[model samples]
Target: MLRPVVVGLDGSRESLTAADWAAREALRRGLPLRLVHAADAPAAGGSDLPELSAPRHWARRILRDAMDQINERYPRLYLSAEQIARPAAEALVSAGGAGELLVLGSRAFSGFGGFLAGSVALQTVTRVERPVVLVRADQTVEDEHTPDPEGRPSADTPYRAVVVGVDAVRPAEQVLAFAFESAALRSTPLRAVYAWRLPMVRAVAEAGAHQTEEAAARRALTAALAPWREKFPTVEVVEQAEEGHPAQRLLSAAQDAGLLAVGRPIRPARLGAHTGPVAHAVMHHVRCPVAIVPHE
Candidate 1:
């Protein structure tokens, strides 16, 4: 069963946007929305006297006001929030044990930033067990300043498109199902993308051999997805097969997407240098909101 979608709020603009998205989403799904804020206790500053940071106290109070605003603005949304005396990621991870989805807002941590996501957003995406959603709060506000390239309001979505990234993994079925369900709800088309890179590039000898192998690869990919297509016949399946890095291809496909869904293994091994390559890449580049699916 899908559990509640939990969002992390650190009283930043990003968190607020994340909260707004989560609220609307939870209401649409008839699911409860859990808003979590983690406030760190003031550290001792050399002198023995424990300094009571007024800002810390005020932060907790701000959460109450924020929650109230959500309650008032989204009357139909089921919303609740909690504050912990720990880091944001830890608090959210603990909450994720029972969460169906975890969401965060991307911030620019680099003081001299040109482009990139903040540490907290990136770390949460890598470490969280459940599927996580990252919102680009920086763009949400800045987008207002620039003229719309699409020549329409950024929020002017007559409909939302559901996009999913699939590879050769068995877990992809879960991701596809989640995307189909979402598309069904929104009555939008479900675009399925399967990115590939020939593992044995050096094996091919002839120039025409590459085309032959590419056709075979595409055929095999379609055969794998046939079962799901048979099941959700109404779902408009837009298949894409490209030769490039999995992450890069997936992100490119998601650029015009409303929601991008990817699957996670049931048991994720402890993240070493870089957990899984595909998901890591998607977390960094995909501009739209991302939904992660976890297997039972």
Candidate 2:
């Protein structure tokens, strides 16, 4: 059976937005869409107030409403909804097992304030092996598309490039593959960004060595992407080497990108879900959708 694209729904605007994004992605991949809700069970020894059951009812209602919207939007798309009695993170991770991709929503802060990804999103992204994408509540389809040359809004505009962070010395194949595939799917260019700065202690020793360092970084990125280029011959690949923080570079590159792809090394369950600094930074700051891919 084909794996479906799963999305976690909590009735929040963020979640609804993610569901819509997932629906469009499902259509693009020709996969089914599954909406999941994790309703926290009532606490034990709690008073049997008549309103106690309202939580369960609300959860079901959320699922129903989301299903209706998605069904109406993608009438031909196969969709299903389920409400599980468990922690949100646990429910999402379990559902992710059978999913081709798992999507969750995030709420962006106002002004220059940073957004919060919530613990559920953090936990799910770290634990799930499948690629998990986080979409901000205010994101629109047009946000993923490029603006007209004259800076006017137009639906006919093509999508912006797909940006992927690369660790030249230790590039992750899973991350590279996903980035290339996304660019190919959208018929957009792929910008592979590698960020590096000489260690403080080596700064003096490496003085006037910026050119050599940049050359090496570029070569590393090119070599790492060689196989993928062959696999995706049509994708226009751009290699960018920047001397700065990886997270900052990626965030800047993603300003106009349709999607930003990053990798999180999978650790044993006992180690817990560590998102690492770079992935953690972008998940909260990037304007575009962020795909957290787990690699061995």
Candidate 3:
């Protein structure tokens, strides 16, 4: 059976927006959509207290409302909902393990143009083995497509390109596969960005070495992407090899992109799970949805 696309929801607009994005992605992947609410367990002796029961009641309401909204928007979609009595972070990580993808919503900064990942979302993203996608509250279906000739948002227009941050020296197969498949599904181009920096000694001493380093970087990027290009012949590939921070280069390339994908190397729990700096930066600043694929 095909695993469903799971979305973690709270009684917030951001979570609802994430549910909506998950619904569309589920449709695109021909998978089911599962809405989950992680409610706190009632106090042992305080179960009879109205305050304790009120939160659980509200949790059910959140799930119900999300179901109704998604159903109205996608009548033909197969959907399911569940309310888990556990801590938010724990529940999200466990629920995501059973699904193909786990999507969480982020709150956009009030005055800034970036999104903020809350403690719960951050914990889940760092720990979950399954791919986690972070969607901003302001993201809409129209934002995933190119504007019309008159420069108006329109879903009828073609989807924008999908961008992926590639590590030329150690490109993760899972990351490339996911990126190529996403672009293939949307019939959009795939922009592969590889960023590197020269050693300080080389930078200061060998001023003419930049051309050589850049050429090598481009070659490495092409080699890393050659097999993916063959695997997805129809996915137009745009390779960008630049000397800079990976996150900065990816952010600039993804300015008009539909989706941005990056890889997170899995580390032992004993060593604490981290999304890494590149994934962290892109998830916060990119307007497009960001997918963090966990790889070994």
Candidate 1 Cα RMSD after full superposition onto the native fold (Å): 4.6
Please list the C-alpha lDDT of all candidates, in the order they appear.
0.69, 0.89, 0.93
How many clashing residue pairs appear in each of the predictions shown?
Answer: 0, 0, 0
Question: Which lDDT tens digits does candidate 3 get at residues 1-296?
Answer: 99999999997888999999999999999999999999877667665777767888888899999999999999989999999989999999999999999999998877765679999999999998899999999999999999999999999999999999999999999999999999999999999999999888897899788888999999999999999999999999999999999999998999999999999999987999999999989878888899999998
Candidate 2, position 43, lDDT: 85
| TM-scores vs. true structure, each candidate | 0.80, 0.93, 0.97
The numbered model that scores best in lDDT is 3
lDDT tens per residue, model 2, 1-296: 99999999999999999999999888878899999999776788776787988888899999999999988988999999999889999999999867998999999967742356998888899889999999999888777788898997665788789999998899898999889988988889999999988766566676667777778887888898898999999999999988999999998898888899999999887877788899999988887889998888
Q: Which 10 consecutive positions of candidate 2 have the poorest summed lDDT? A: 107-116
Evaluation by lDDT, superior candidate among 1 and 3: 3
Models sorted by TM-score, best on top: 3, 2, 1
RMSD of each: 4.6, 2.2, 1.4
